[model samples]
Structures are given as C-alpha cells and as structure tokens.
Target chain A: MSLLAAGGLAVGYRRGRRAPLTLVADVDLSLAAGELVCLVGPNGAGKSTLLRTLAGLQRPLAGRVTLAGADLHAMDARERAQRLATVWTGPVEVGLMAARELVALGRHPHTGWSGRLRAADEAAIDAALAAVDAAELAWQPVDQLSDGQRQKINIARALAQEPQLLLLDEPAAWLDLARRAEIMALLQRLARQQGCAVLLSSHDLELALRHADRLWLMSGDGTLRAGAPEDLALGGALSTAFRSAGLHYDALEGKFVSLQPRSGGPTVALHGSGTAASWTRRALERGGYRVCEPGCERAARAAVKVLQQGWELRLGSSRRRCESLESLLSALAAAPVD
Target chain B: MIRAQWRWPGATLLPGRLHSDPLQRQRLRRALLQGGLLCLVLALFLLSLMLGSVNIPPDEVLRSLSRAGAGESAWERIVLLIRLPKALTALLAGAALGVSGLLMQTLFRNPLAGPYVLGISSGASLGVALVLLGAGGTLGVTLVAGLGLGGSLALAGAAMTGAALVLLLVLLVARAVGSNMTLLVLGVMLGFLTSALVSMLLYFSVPEQVQAYVNWSFGSFGTVSWRELRVMAPLLLAGLTLAALLAKPLDALLPGEQVAQGLGLNVRRARLQVMLATAVLAGTVTAFCGPVGFLGIAVPHLCRSLAGTSCHRTLLPACMLCGAALALVAALVAELPGSNLVLPLNAVMALLGAPVVIHVLLRRRNLRRVFAS
Candidate 1:
C-alpha cells in the first residue's frame, strides 16, 4: 500500500466574492514507502500548490487524499503531522536557535504540552543530525551557518519528525552545484535506508533525472506526467514538456541541447572526440564559429584539429598550434573573416 | 584530544550535564541571570519601601511589612500605607507590560511591537478620557455604574473594554495585512487616531476634570491604592498565567505562521489567546497606572539580549523578573530617594529604557537575531 495517495485533486485559491482560480486539477499521485519521487516543473507551474495539497496543508478543491487507508484531510493536525512532514523553500527565521534546537523542533507532534524533549526525542534529534552529517554543527547558531549547512539542518529537522512520508517544495533551489547534488544524494539515501517516502520539487532537472527514483513532471500546461526518468525521456515527454523554440532535450546525452547562433562569417572544421573535444566544440560555438561535419570539412575556410596536447588551427594553408581554447579563439579572431 | 570548555557569561558549572552540553550551559546561565535579577528586585523593593517622600529605616520598613497593624508611628504609617502599595503596583505593572510586549512581538513577528507601540494603551486612555472627562457623560457613567463599580473600578472596566475592542480590531487588521512593517504603521496610525479623540474630549471637559486627566496622563505607580491592588493583582496574574501556557505555541510561531501550522499548532486559536492575554495585561496596568511607557517595549529586549535566546519558555520568565526589577529601579529613581521632589514615572522610564533600545538597534546584528525578518 502507498504511504500517501491523492486522487482527482484540484488545487487553487479563492478570491473575494468570485470563482476560485484553479491552477491545477484532475491529478492522481501516490508515494510508496521507501520511494523517492522528484516533482519537476517550470516556475509557477503549480508545483508548490500540488505539494501543499498532498501534504494536507491546504484543502483540496475537489477530491480526497488518503494516508494509510485513512482520509488525510479528515485527520487532526497532530495526527497528520505524526505521519507526514513538509519542508518549504523559503528561508527560516530562527533567532538565537542552535542547529540542534531547530532540528529538535521537528518532534513537535510527539512532545507534550510544554515541548520538553524526552530521551527518545533527543535520540531522534541526534540520529537525524548524524543522518545529515551535521553533528559537528549541532552547537552552532543557525544564523551563523552557511547556506548549504542551513539546508542540511532543515532536512535534519524534517527527519526528526520521524514521518512515513515527507514532502519538500524546492529544497535545493538555492545551492551550489556540489551542494545540490549532495542534497539529492542525501534525500535518496534517507528514503531507502529509513523506508520513508520522499517527494521534493526541484528546478534542477539534470540532478532530478539522475538521482530521482521516479519523476512527476508537471508541464507548462498544468498536466503531470509521472514515470521513471529514462522512460519519460525515451517517451519524448521531457522534450515536449520543456519545449522551447531555442532548445530541445538530448535524449541520448540526458541533457538539454542548444547552440548559439553562428556568426555567419567564420566557418571552422573542428575534429575531435572525448571531453576536450566537446568543450572545444562549446568554445567554438560560443565564439560564433560554424563547426562543419565530415562532408563539409574539406570545403571549410578554417580547419581546427584537436590534438593530444594542443589545438592545431589551419587557416588557408597556414598552421598555428594554440595552447588553449582561449588562444585558439584569439587565433581565430586574428584570422581574416571571410 | 582534550575538549576545551569555555565559560558562557554567568554560567556556573553544574555536575552531570554542564561538561559538554551547550544547552545545559545556556540553561544554567539563564538561571544565574534570573537569580541575580530576583535578588536585585528584592533589594530594590526594600529600597522603594524605605526611601520615599518620608524616609523610613530598613528595619522599620521590615517591621511594618512583617507585623500587621504595627504601632501607628509616622514611619510605619508611611511604609505600610503609602510606599508598599506603590512598590507592589510598580512590580505588577512592569511584569504585565513586559509579558504583554513579548506576546505582541511574537504574534506580529516584529521586534518593535508592544502594547503602547501597537496603540492598545491609547485605546485604554481613550476609555479613561471618556469616563473622567465626562465626554460620554451618562452613557459611560451608567455603563460602569450599572456593573456596581465606582471610581477606579469603573475606570478599570472601561479601559479593559476599550483595550479588548482595539485589540480585536488590530487582530482583524492583522489578518488582512501581510507585512509586519505595514501592521506596525497601521498600529501607530490607530494610536494617533485614539489620542486625537482623547485630546478632543479633553478640550470640552471642565478645568477640574481636565486636571484629573492630565495628572493621570503623566503616568504614576503611586496612584494605585491598596483597594485597587485587589482588582489589579488577579487580572495581571491571570494574564501572566495565560501567557505562560502559550510558551510552546509562541516558540512554534517563531519560524512563520504557515510553518507553525505545519508543526500542528492551532495558529488561529493561539493567536487569539495571545491577544487576549495582551489585552488583559496591558489594559489592567494602564487603567491603574495610567499608560506607563517604556517598560513594555524595553523589558523584553533586555531579557532577550541578556538571555541570548528567543525561546518563549525562558523568555517569559526572564521578562517577568527583569521587568519587575527595572520598574522598581525606575520607581526608586522617580522617588528622588532622599528629597521630597518626585520625578514623573514615564520620564524616569524613558531615561532608563531608551538607551537599552538604542543599544539594541545600533548593534544591528543583535536586532537581526531578535527579529524574524
């Protein structure tokens, strides 16, 4: 059985004395135990709305959400909090709170009226901090933490809640590439090891594709397409969902494909393979050079060969060995534009 | 490797938990500070009793306090009849305002929020103006008299009713206003509106009634008699009890309203409880003490900075203790100790309170740490 399931749910906001605005509707989603799902969409495509609806923070306009065979919305807040937790993208304002104290707050539902942490609650907090590799930061004030550390501490706080289902709205929205990947990996590990269902919305499609167990892709038209990452890519759902005039999804490469418009004056026959060759292609493209294929290489005005140590630039029978991509670009610039 | 243990301010090393637990160390330090403040409050309370317009010796003051119906000497009469009630009134008012201020700050998530800052005091003053100035005449008089109350009791009832009404209005407006800055500005505007109404009422009153209103507006703890304490103490105690019960909800609300709700806190009900506590505390104090300023806004900040934590469980008690101490100090200073000349209570409070506020603001980082922006 799924940990949480939503069927025929419609989410929207009501204005004063008017019809409610429906941002998304007719959605069916389920999160299974120990499964990690990534909710991916463009900005303002109702990702947060759907996440809020699933978490039971907001009432659904149409249908019901069930958790463990019971209606999620019908449960009291404390009961729901015991079963599920949510983390938001907005920065938390915690004044003079240490990392441990903040994480311990996630045990809110389990604690008594005074919120005194029992021994069990303390153990949970310690385990959560260790889970996020943030035990060293337990004593540090939250305001003094780096952005990456703060995000980890936030995740730890949610973990301390000991929920069967966790929902996060864009938890990795503001982080460096390394930190973003680390967070994704951590979430994946937590879901597997703790047998907790994890669902998070993220704009980092590349990381989502690589690390997410399954994908719930919400397109610009407010329709959700859920499947395995590779299956979605192979079915052309990713391409259609993220379609733009200037870009297309590269299925084989598992990334977006777009090139700068050629300068229309300089044409270069570039030859290479591997990482260096791909980077050189990007540099040449950025420099507004038209890189020719095998058929057009012999007829090109400028030909560049990717060698073992350096780039060999040949322009009209004159050869120059450029040490780097920067030098190669400058050499092309110095060459006559014809 | 040997672990380094540096001492936090005022922290005493307690066995079992004090070795490496920073949380326990913080608790110990807060306890030390509270203990010191309790001593200071006692010392100041004794000083307030001993050094009034007529100076009574410490032994004499203690004798008068310990022995009921002691010899009817001038010193005993001064200590028992006059200064004891005044000192008790200061302590109660200070504590009420402090806790009220903390609640307002947390409810709105604005550091500058207080009963006076949010115009709740002005609402009370407006109620008193209607009664004392006879602007409402038979309507206000009959309203209080109908309840079998007279004199200060009528003023207390009218003031509390006005405060509750204004607080109700503010809470309604708080729902509509999203920004804390906007809510504070609206509160200031409400203050201005109520004060203007008060001024208009004062304009039409007779000279004798106007003098009574003016004297009350100067803000004094000495005006509350032993009879009034009967009414004031229970109301303030009830407010304090209610605030203590809300400590967990207030801590949960520190993150934001939505986050608090997600934490299983009933945000709306908690908010109403907080407002109710604020109204009772601020209104009862204002009705008796005449809109005493600075203690409400300043005491909470003092407690936060001294304790270095915003956890309401710690803060509520700290505010109570620190607030009582500060008010006693202000009352003692306003008494002018040796001389018969007395300074205005509000003037003394401003002289003591404004510097603390300025110091908090100028530090910038402390201000950031106190408020949830």
Candidate 2:
C-alpha cells in the first residue's frame, strides 16, 4: 500500500540574527492510498513549506518523512524519484520543449545510463497526457499554452512519473474557476483510479472541502488539524482555522457566508415563526436597530407590513422613512438623535 | 478512433498499417547516420593529409605511409613529418573543442556559453603570456616559445581553475538574479575582465615576445609535437568521453535544476563533472592552438540546427563531426599555396562563423515561429 507519513515535522527559517520564525510546528499527518488530501491555511501558515519538505526539496530541521515504508531522507535520489513526484508553481525556463518531452522527463529514473526512452516509457507518457486531457497538446510547446493549460501539462508531467505519492504546491493558483474545478476533479480521479496518494495545497477552501477526501487544516496558532473535510467543518475547525471575521460558518450550507446587515429602519410587525423571525431579528440588531413586536407604541410609530410588499413607514419614527429594508436603516442613522 | 490513431502515430495502432514505429525507427536511423558521418569524417581527415601547400600524390602518400622513407624525399617528409601529425591534431582538437562547447552550453543552459565566453581561453592566454613575456629575455625566443609547452599545461590547469571559479560565481548569482540573461551578462563581463588583463600584458611586452604571443593567440594545429600528442590525445579522448556519458543527465538538466534533481540526477555532481570535462577539453585545445575562436561556440549551434533537436544524444556527436569538418576546412584554406604566409585559423573561422551568428540572430523570431507552427 502506498502511504505518505510525516511525524513531528518542524520547519523554521531565520530572517536574520534573531530567533527563528517557526512555520510548521510538531505536525503529524498520514495519507493512505486512494486518498486525496487538500492543505488549506492562511498566509504564512506553512502550507507551502510543508509541501516542499514532503517533496524532498526542503529538509526539515527536525522530524522525518516517509513514503510507502521507505525513509525519504535515506533513499537514493533515483529511488526517491521513482516513488514520489512533485509539481511546484514556477516557470520552467526551457521554453521550446514540447509537452510530450516535458512529460517524458518523468521517466528519467527508469531510463538506463543512456537515458534512451523505451517503448514502455512512451506509452506511459501518452497515458499521462491522456489522464490530464493534454494529449492534444502533446506536440505543442508548453510556452504556447495558456496559464491554465500549462498548469495541466505540468500536472501531466508529474503524473507521468507514475509515482505512488504526488505532491503539488498550489496547483490551482493560476487557474480560473472552471479550470480550477477541472484540475481538482482530475486530481481526485487520479487518486481513485490509480490509487495514488495525492496532496495539494490550495487557497480555494470551498472547492477543497467539496472535493478532497481529507483535509489538513493549518490553524493560525501553530497547530495542524487533520480529518475528513466534513468532520473538520463540523468541528468548527475550518472557521477557526481561516479566522475570517466577516464570515460565519453555515452548518446547513456547509460553507461560509457573508452576514449582511438588514437595511430597513427597526420598524416592523413580526408575524413569522421563531426560526425566520429570530434570524431577521439578529440581522436587524447587527444592523444597529431595536426590534419591536406587533402593536407596541414603538411598533405603532413604525411602518406596517403589507401583504406582498414587506414593510413601509407610518407616523413619527425618528424622522426616518422606511422605503426598503436597506434604505430605512441608513435613514434611521441619518435622523436626529432624540 | 482512426483519426486518433493516425494523429498520434506512436500512441495507438492502426489496422493494416504495418510501418515500423516512426520514433523508434527514426532513432535507429539517426544512430546509423551518425555512425556513417563519423566514418566519413575519418576518411576526409585522411584525405586532408594529402592536400596541403605541397600537394603529395595520393599514391605517393600511401607509399610513404607503408614505409616512412621509401617515397620521394619531399613527399616522405611532408606526409610523415607535416601532414599526418597536423591533420590528426586538428581532428582531435576540433572534436574536443566541439564537445566542450556543447557541454558548456547545455550545463549553463545558455546558447552563448562556451570556452571563450567563460574566460577559460583568457586564463590560458595569461599562462602563455607569463611564459612568453616574463621568461623571454633570460630564455632565448625559441626557449621562451618552448616554454609554451609547459605554459599550455599550466594554462589548462589555470583555465580549469578559472572555469570553476566562474561556475561558482554564476551559481551564486543565479540565486540572487532570477534571469538567465543576467547570468550570461555576468559571464561575459568576467571574460572581458580577463581579456583586458591580457591586453595590458601584451602592451608592456617586448617586440620579440609580442610576436611570439601573437602567433600563439592566432592558434594553429601544427604546434603539437609527437611527444605532446602522446599527452594531449588521451586527455582529449577522456574529456569527450565524459561529456558523451553526461548526455542523458545534461538533457534532464535542460528543463531546470529542480526538475533534474527530481529526476534522480545528483545535480551538484553532474554539474561538477560537466565543468571539469569542459575545462579539460577547452584547456587542452587552447594550450595547443592559442585560443581558437568560433569553433567551440558556433559548431554546437550548427549541429543543433542540422539535427533539429536539442537532445544531447544526437547533438554531441553531430557537433564533434561538424567541428572537425569545419576546422579541417579552415586548416585547408589557411594552407592554400598562393599565400606562402599561412592565414591565421581564427580569421578563417570568423569569416564563416560571424555570418552564421548574425543570421541566427536576425532570423531568430521567424525560426521560433516556424518551430511553433
């Protein structure tokens, strides 16, 4: 079984002569075969560092990483290459190379001393291009591709390695929304069809949550939380991990939503049930107004709720005209404080 | 499905289409073609020995070859003493420099990088200058010139040292400057600085010493003696072999350092090997020939264009053949009978190389567009 595991992994960098700024602290994670994991974090939360370390491009100051029962640090470069493949977000400067040639580079570990690609190597390259839907662009120079298309080709190159563990650093960073979905779908499909353990870092939390089999959430407080996406989302770990103040975690929608303030002045006769009215009442309060029930003196001065058209302003209500929910709130704020 | 099979010739099989797979067949065909070309180069090299200032009849040349002293007096001396050794030196040096230039270009990932561009030639010049200028008076002119023998060896060592130093600096600068063009400019500046130092030495040296230095700088294949060839030949062979061995790893490096490393090549070791091989090849040729120009830089580009692929497997041997042929042609032109005074080899190369370089630069855009199309 192919498995990727990291234990007590600590990564840090020194800016100058001062104490080192820790990026990932005592993190432990494991990904099994046929599993796809998405790593999400805020800026400077060590997501990229973690990916780099796992890819063997960066050495961890402490702790160890292992791939499929092999110690990553101890394996020879060729053996390690045969087991793992990584794609980073950087421009490969050899501009005129064809897409197929780029993918064939993945077979470097398998080729002999002469590096003559065999028939099997060619077949593997073709399979990789097809897997990523890049077969049509095989003969085209990668420089000619759009950013999104190039990203797919890069992924195809990694896939051609036929590695058990695939690590990608921000694969979706340059892609548009639809292309991003397509790439994510491809990654998921690869994990399932080929039984490759895939781990990718991304800023697109909603897509990651929806698609990934597992999530590694790097909390702002130097902690890494790992579980199924739904488990972490239900545990209040995602909202806390993202720490976006303007957003609230919606259990029903299984996503974050922007809490917009109610606009109309605090003049309304509430006739709805507790659930709807409570939400409306909370929204109104957050918009800076007092909620009044039906037939109170404050409610009398406020507007009456019409059958189909919602609320309209009545008598003296703080010199505010309640036209719609949005305008009324601004009007109330503009009125003289009496 | 039929269209797909035809479009991707190697990917899928077409019914009743019995052609051998093109890519594999083409690779074999190219291999055979390169082998044939190498044989042709050998034959032409032997033929060059027959055509020189004093044209020896092919039959007489063969007679002299069978028994050194049996042919006509002048023909015997010419074939034995002059033509054979000179042709051999030219072929070996050409092959070495061609391979050297190819290695440096691939390692640096720059089309312009070569022995001359990286200041290895300048280091050799410095060694020659020390021997020619510093030791000229105490040691007579011939003795001082003979010091060139030792001077060249030392120069090869020094050039290797200089190459390593520049390589280290480029690697360091590469970290700071993200652009390949910037690294190329830095390498060129290094070359200029070394050349400037050589020029200052030239200005201060005596007239006799200056003449000796000038001859050395003009470069010739006739300078390597039988004794020197014993030492030089093996070194050139070894260096070229090392470069050929590095073909696969070098191709991997073309994409980028990270990708190459990920492909399981020890990037640091591979780079060092390439640098050392280039130094030996360039250093030996420069020591013997007085810093031959254009062959090392332009020959690889010519091979790449002809082969239509940057894959080192084809490019390296192609470069070696092309370089040997070009150098032999230059040597032949220099030895033309009308000019009893031999033309400098570098001047002949510039006549051929400069125009190609200009043409490459002029048509670069159109070429790239055509390749893309």
Full-model lDDT for every candidate:
0.84, 0.74
A83-117: candidate 2 lDDT, tens digit per residue: 89888765565534567877888888989999888
Best by the DockQ measure:
1
| lDDT over C-alpha atoms for residue B201 of model 1 | 89
Model 1 per-residue lDDT tens digits across residues B314-369: 89988998888888988989989778888888989999778876786576457676
In Å, residue B293's CA in model 2 sits off its true spot by: 2.9
TM-score of 2: 0.78
- Fraction of true contacts retained by every candidate, in order, equals 0.62, 0.48
Model 2 Cα displacement at A25 (Å)?
A: 0.3
Question: How do the candidates score on chain B by TM-score?
Answer: 0.86, 0.81
lDDT of 1: 0.84
